[model samples]
Target: MEEESWQSITVMEDKNGEPHVLQQKVKVYTSGVSEESPGYTKPLMKHRIVPVKDIVNL
Candidate 1:
Protein backbone atom coordinates (compact mmCIF):
# COMPACT_ATOMS: atom_id res chain seq x y z
CA MET A 1 0.00 0.00 0.00
CA GLU A 2 1.05 3.69 -0.61
CA GLU A 3 0.13 7.07 0.88
CA GLU A 4 -0.47 10.18 -1.22
CA SER A 5 -0.89 13.98 -0.90
CA TRP A 6 -1.27 17.11 -3.06
CA GLN A 7 -0.41 20.82 -3.05
CA SER A 8 -0.51 23.90 -5.31
CA ILE A 9 1.67 26.98 -5.66
CA THR A 10 2.73 29.74 -8.05
CA VAL A 11 6.25 29.79 -9.36
CA MET A 12 8.57 30.54 -12.24
CA GLU A 13 9.17 28.52 -15.40
CA ASP A 14 9.95 24.83 -15.22
CA LYS A 15 12.52 22.95 -17.26
CA ASN A 16 9.91 22.63 -20.01
CA GLY A 17 9.74 26.45 -20.19
CA GLU A 18 6.20 26.62 -18.87
CA PRO A 19 5.41 29.62 -16.70
CA HIS A 20 2.41 30.42 -14.51
CA VAL A 21 0.64 29.17 -11.43
CA LEU A 22 0.60 25.48 -12.23
CA GLN A 23 -1.74 22.96 -10.71
CA GLN A 24 0.02 19.76 -9.81
CA LYS A 25 -0.49 16.62 -7.74
CA VAL A 26 2.25 15.13 -5.59
CA LYS A 27 2.61 11.47 -4.67
CA VAL A 28 4.77 9.52 -2.22
CA TYR A 29 5.39 5.79 -2.01
CA THR A 30 6.70 3.39 0.59
CA SER A 31 9.72 1.35 -0.42
CA GLY A 32 10.59 -2.22 0.43
CA VAL A 33 12.31 -3.45 3.54
CA SER A 34 15.99 -2.75 4.09
CA GLU A 35 18.51 -5.53 3.75
CA GLU A 36 20.69 -4.36 6.63
CA SER A 37 17.81 -4.20 9.10
CA PRO A 38 15.08 -6.72 9.65
CA GLY A 39 11.44 -5.67 10.13
CA TYR A 40 12.50 -2.15 9.18
CA THR A 41 11.30 -0.41 6.06
CA LYS A 42 12.54 2.64 4.21
CA PRO A 43 10.28 5.23 2.64
CA LEU A 44 10.92 6.27 -0.94
CA MET A 45 9.62 9.59 -2.13
CA LYS A 46 9.12 10.50 -5.78
CA HIS A 47 7.71 13.59 -7.45
CA ARG A 48 6.25 14.15 -10.89
CA ILE A 49 5.27 17.52 -12.35
CA VAL A 50 2.55 17.91 -14.95
CA PRO A 51 2.04 21.20 -16.76
CA VAL A 52 -1.49 22.53 -17.02
CA LYS A 53 -0.58 25.52 -19.16
CA ASP A 54 1.32 26.26 -22.32
CA ILE A 55 5.10 26.54 -22.44
CA VAL A 56 6.67 29.96 -22.65
CA ASN A 57 10.06 31.63 -22.67
CA LEU A 58 11.25 33.94 -19.92
Candidate 2:
Protein backbone atom coordinates (compact mmCIF):
# COMPACT_ATOMS: atom_id res chain seq x y z
CA MET A 1 0.00 0.00 0.00
CA GLU A 2 1.09 3.56 -0.64
CA GLU A 3 0.16 7.00 0.69
CA GLU A 4 0.93 10.45 -0.54
CA SER A 5 0.85 14.06 0.70
CA TRP A 6 1.28 17.30 -1.17
CA GLN A 7 1.83 20.99 -0.50
CA SER A 8 1.80 23.88 -2.97
CA ILE A 9 3.73 27.11 -2.91
CA THR A 10 3.48 30.06 -5.30
CA VAL A 11 7.00 30.63 -6.54
CA MET A 12 6.50 33.04 -9.46
CA GLU A 13 4.34 33.88 -12.43
CA ASP A 14 5.50 33.80 -16.01
CA LYS A 15 4.01 35.45 -19.07
CA ASN A 16 1.92 32.35 -19.67
CA GLY A 17 0.45 31.98 -16.22
CA GLU A 18 1.12 31.53 -12.54
CA PRO A 19 3.58 28.78 -11.67
CA HIS A 20 3.68 26.75 -8.50
CA VAL A 21 6.22 24.70 -6.58
CA LEU A 22 5.10 21.47 -5.05
CA GLN A 23 6.39 19.61 -2.04
CA GLN A 24 5.51 15.94 -2.17
CA LYS A 25 5.79 13.24 0.43
CA VAL A 26 5.32 9.56 -0.22
CA LYS A 27 5.04 6.58 2.06
CA VAL A 28 5.41 3.00 0.95
CA TYR A 29 4.41 0.01 3.02
CA THR A 30 5.60 -3.47 2.42
CA SER A 31 5.24 -6.87 4.01
CA GLY A 32 8.47 -7.99 5.54
CA VAL A 33 8.08 -11.57 4.39
CA SER A 34 11.45 -12.31 2.83
CA GLU A 35 13.60 -15.40 2.55
CA GLU A 36 15.37 -14.42 5.75
CA SER A 37 12.29 -14.40 7.94
CA PRO A 38 8.90 -12.89 8.47
CA GLY A 39 9.40 -9.68 10.39
CA TYR A 40 8.03 -6.22 10.92
CA THR A 41 9.74 -3.45 9.01
CA LYS A 42 9.26 0.25 9.16
CA PRO A 43 7.52 2.03 6.34
CA LEU A 44 9.68 3.74 3.73
CA MET A 45 9.25 7.46 3.18
CA LYS A 46 10.43 9.81 0.48
CA HIS A 47 10.30 13.55 -0.14
CA ARG A 48 10.52 15.60 -3.34
CA ILE A 49 10.20 19.16 -4.53
CA VAL A 50 9.14 19.79 -8.13
CA PRO A 51 7.51 22.36 -10.34
CA VAL A 52 3.79 22.04 -10.98
CA LYS A 53 4.25 22.76 -14.66
CA ASP A 54 6.69 19.89 -15.04
CA ILE A 55 4.16 17.42 -13.71
CA VAL A 56 1.32 18.91 -15.71
CA ASN A 57 3.30 18.68 -18.91
CA LEU A 58 4.18 15.07 -18.32
- lDDT measured at residue 33 in model 2 versus the true structure, 0 to 100: 55
Model 2 residue runs over 4 Å out of place are: 1-17, 30-47
- Cα misplacement distance, residue 5 of candidate 2 (Å): 9.9
Model 1 lDDT on a 0 to 1 scale:
0.47
lDDT, candidate 2, residue 43? 31
User: In candidate 1, what are the lDDT values of residues 1-58, reduced to their tens digit?
Assistant: 3445544445667776865454445554445454333332233344345454533443
Clashing pairs in 1: none
lDDT of 2 by residue, 1-58 (tens): 3334454433655566756564535343445454455433333354455656676874
- Give the Å shift of residue 20 in candidate 2: 1.9
What stretches of model 1 exceed 4 Å from their correct place?
Answer: 1-3, 20-44, 54-58
Q: Please report how far candidate 1 places residue 12 from its true position, in Å.
A: 3.7
RMSD of each: 10.7, 8.3
TM-score of each: 0.26, 0.29
